[model samples]
Structure formats: C-alpha cells, structure tokens
Target: MSVVSDTIDWFSDSTHWSGDDGVPHRLVQHLGYTSLTIAIAAAVAIPIGLWIGHTGRLRGLAVVSSGALRALPTLGVLTYASLYTGIGIKAAIFTLVLLAIPPLLAGAYAGLESVDRQTIDAARSIGMTEWQILTKVEVPLALPLIVGGFRSSTLQVVATATVAAYIPGPGGLGRYLIDGLALRDYPQVVAGSVVVIVLALVLDGIFVLLQRLALRNRPAPVRSTV
Candidate 1:
C-alpha cells in the first residue's frame, strides 16, 4: 500500500513529467532504440528466412540456429558488447539487434513454410514464376504469422531496452527505475515499471491492429459451386 501510494505521488509530481530527463523524453528515446534495432533485425533476418523457406534447403539449419540465437542472454550480450564498444547507445543497439533477430527469422521462415503445398502447385500450374508464387501466394498467406513474430520481437526489445539505462549514457524509462533504485526512491521505481508496462501494452495493441489489417486484406478463397 505504501509503495502504491508513493507511485501515485511520483506520478502526480509535475516535475517528473517535464525536462530532458522526463518521462516523455525517455519514452521517445526508448522507442527510437527499439524501432531502429527491430528494423535492422528484420532487414537482415527476414530475407534469409524467406530464401531458406522458398528454396526448401537448410531450413532445419535455420530453425536450429534461430533457437540457439533466442537462447542467448540479452544482458550478457549487452555487457560484453559494452565492454568492447565502451558503453553507449551503439552497444545497446547492437545487443538489441542480436536479441531481435531470432524471432523475426523464425517467423519469416515459419510463415513461408506454413503455406500449403497445393497452393504453391496451383500457382506453378497457372504459369506463375517462382518469384510470383512467393510474392503473390506464400507471402500474403504467411503475413499473419510473420507479423506475430514481429510483434513478439518488438515486445521483447521494448522490455529489454529499459536495461540500456544501466549503460553509461542517456537511457529510456529504465533510467527512472535504475536511478530510483540507486537512490532508494521506491515510488519512482514503481512509476517507471508502470510506464514500461503501459508502453509494451500500447505497442502490442498497435501490432495487433496491423496483424488484423493484414489478414483482412488477404484475398478470399475461391469456392466451387456444386
């Protein structure tokens, strides 16, 4: 109860809402980090995944590799990268990119593989080239799962970005949590946690909408009238 009361007080304080170190600024910083890292991971991972899926070669390798990558500890990578890169947003971004890649890769390949073989054969029978079959058939169908993977990756990255505050530079909302802990300001720490949770929920909602839109735009199946 005391912690809740302190959190409310911390939020009520106007000073916490305004300044370079305020919630809004930190939120933006966190979003920037997340967006860039995910973008890079997507660019690198999706194409490779798609290619592997389309070719039907080395797919087991891709899956196993993604699983291994996902098992990596984010903080350990962050710490190691910071040691070599000397602690900054760059190192944090690098660590996050590594963390973000596996899901995106897995999603892409899974989405591609999930497409029905009959559909691919139908496309081929219709004189559709390999590229057309992929773009027009497989990709469209796989979109939901692909987006699901992206959503998962985004959520993970957003949560992890908070840890960037522990590095020696300006950080996101995690700053509030880290600083509050160092100073024993429990209220501030709680407030920071609430903010992070809210951000994750909001981002997740956006992705849900995106996934729905993708599904909604998907072409309806052709049915035969008896």
Candidate 2:
C-alpha cells in the first residue's frame, strides 16, 4: 500500500473516509447560514421592492440590477465578497443578498404595479388613508408576488450557500469539493456534489410548500370582467 494506493482506497470507501474534519457538521452550519441570508435579503429587499412598487420610483434600477445579478455567477460574487469581507459565510451571505435583491424587487414592483388604478382611486374616495392603501390594498394585493419573490430568493440562497466553502470556515459540502479537487479524490467530490444538490432541492421544496400556504391564505383578488 503505497501513498497513492492508500489515498485511492480511502476515496473508494466513502464510509471510512473523512475528507476534511467534520464535513457533516459543516453542512449543518452552512445550512444555518443560508437560512440567515434568506432572512436578511428578504428584510432588505421586501421593503425596497415594496417602496419601488408602491411609489413607482427607480424600477428601472431594480430591473437592471436584479437582471444583472442573475447573470453574475455565484463564484464571481463570492470572489468579490471574499476580497472585501475576508471569507466564510459573510462573503456567502453578501453574495446571496445581492442575488436575492432582484427577485424581491421584481416581485414587489410587479405586485404593487398590479394594483388596480380604479381601486386605488376608490380607496382614496372613501377617505382611506395612504397608509391604509399601502398596508391594506397594495400589500395584500401584492402579497402573492412578494411571497413568490421570497420563495425564489430562498432557493437561490440555499444553492449559493454551498459556494461559501470556497471562502473558509467549515466548508460545508463544498470543502469536500475544494479538497477533493486538490487531492484528486473523485469519491469525495461526487459525494459532496450529490449532497449539495439534494439539499438545495429539499430546501426549495420547503419554500414552495410555504409559498403555496401563503397563496392559499391571501384573498381572491377582485377584478372587473368588463
């Protein structure tokens, strides 16, 4: 059992292999982080998106920015954030937050824009306060779209969290990927890849369920057929 043979054997037996300390622990830790990023992005994006949709200002900026963010690769943004923020989940979160902004903005804008002009006028005619119009009419009408945006953002964040391993800290499943690539361990690479993809799908599935619940609770929108 030469060194190469030993490493090859280790790679072949995944059950016996521990590629980078505690990879399972890292995966859990990164999952927590991905959750936080979703919260933060939603907090920041929802309001901005709401305001943009409600007031109808700087929508072009939101449109351009979110579209651009979508085109940007997770690795590219991770690299940029790592340069500024050092590494770890901070960079991952920052990158994800940017990724998150576009959908929220688009959803919020679309939601608010979807509000009927006549309904707005009607609300005004009855002496409904501006705040009332916003909280009651605008937000409620736009709720579905807003939730969809969040659901979309959550899925994106879940996937992007895997990239955080490139920064440092635990490494999540990505650490295996990074280490496996370096050591030429295909088993670890395949395993890590499988874990990340499966987890991403599972997380997105939960968000979809929640989104459906939200849609169900919202009032059926009123519209004139004429």
Candidate 3:
C-alpha cells in the first residue's frame, strides 16, 4: 500500500513532469533508441531471411543462428560492449540491435516458407518471374508473419532499452528505475516500470492492428460453381 501510494504521489508531482529528466523526455529518448535499433535490425535481418527462404538454402544456418542469438544475454552483451567500446548510446544500440535481429529473421524466413508451394508453382506456370512471384504473391501472403516479427522485435527492444540507464550516460525510462533504486526511491521505480509496461502495450496494440489490416487486405479465396 505504501509503495502504491508513493507511486501515485510520484506521478502526481508536477515538478517531476517539468524537469529535463521528466517522463516525456525519457519516453522520447527511449522511443528514438528503439526505433533506430529496430530499423537497423530489420534492414540487416529481413533481407537475409527473405533470401534464404526464397532460395531454400542455408535454412539450417538460419535456425542455428536464430537460436544462438536468442540464447545470448542482452545484459552480458551490453556489459562486454561497455568494457570494449566504453559506455554510451553506441554500445547500447549495438547490443540492442543484436537482441532485435533473431525474431525478425525468423519471421521473415518462416513467413515466406509458409506460403503454399502450389501457389508458387501456379505463379510460375502463369509465366510470373521469380521476382514477381515473390513480390506479388509471397510477400503479400507473408505480411502478417512479417509484421508479427516486427511486433516481437519492438516489444523486446522496448523492454531492454530501459536497461540502457545502467550504461552511465543519457538513457531512456530505465534511468528512472535505476536511479530510483540507487536513491532508494521505490515510488519512482514503480512508476518507471509502469511507464515501460504501458509503452509496450501501446506499441503492441498498434502492431496487432497492422497485422490484422494486412491480413484483411489479402485477396479473398476463389469460389467454384458446381
């Protein structure tokens, strides 16, 4: 009860809202970090994934790599990066990009693979080039899964970006939690956690809508008359 009350008090305080370290500033910082990291990860992973899926080659490599990437500890990566590269947004972004890649890669390849082989054959029969088949048929069919991968990557990055505060420089909402802990301010810690959760939920909701919209726009199935 005391913790909850303190959290409410912390949120209600106008001074906290006005400072440079305020929620709005931190939120923007966090989002910037997240967006940049996700964009880089998508750029790197999606192309490779799509190629592997389309060519039906190196799939085992993709599986092994995805698993290895997933098993890596983000904190450990950050710690090592800080040790070698020194603490700053660069090291943080590097670590976060690594963290964001696996799911995006998996989704891209899996979505492409999941497309009906018969459909591909039909497209080929109709004289569609490989590029045309991929762009017109496979890509549209696989959009939901691709967007799903983006959603997963976004959520993971948002949660992990909070850990950036531990890097000893400008940071996102994680600063609240880390600083609160250092100062023994439980209310601030709770508030920071709530903010991260709310942000994740909102991003997730938007991604969900995108996935549904992609699926909804897919062409309807053909009907056969007896």
Off by over 4 Å in 1: 217-226
lDDT of 3 by residue, 4-36 (tens): 989999999987786678999889999999999
* lDDT winner between candidates 2 and 3: 3
Clashing pairs in 3: none
lDDT of 1 by residue, 1-226 (tens): 8999889988899998888878898899889889999999999999998898788889889878877888988878888888888967888999889888888888888888878899999999989999999899998888887888899999999998888778777488889888989999889999999999999999999988988887796665421100
Write down the lDDT of every candidate, Cα atoms only.
Answer: 0.86, 0.73, 0.88
Positional deviation of residue 145's Cα in model 1 after best superposition, in angstroms: 0.6
Clashes of each: 0, 0, 0
- The best-first sequence of candidates by lDDT reads 3, 1, 2
Better of 1 and 3 by lDDT: 3
Identify the runs in model 3 with alpha carbons over 4 angstroms from their true place: 219-226
Error of 3 at 217 (Å): 3.4
Residues forming the 10-long window of minimal summed lDDT in candidate 3: 217-226
TM-score, one value per model: 0.93, 0.79, 0.95
Candidate closest to the true structure, highest lDDT: 3
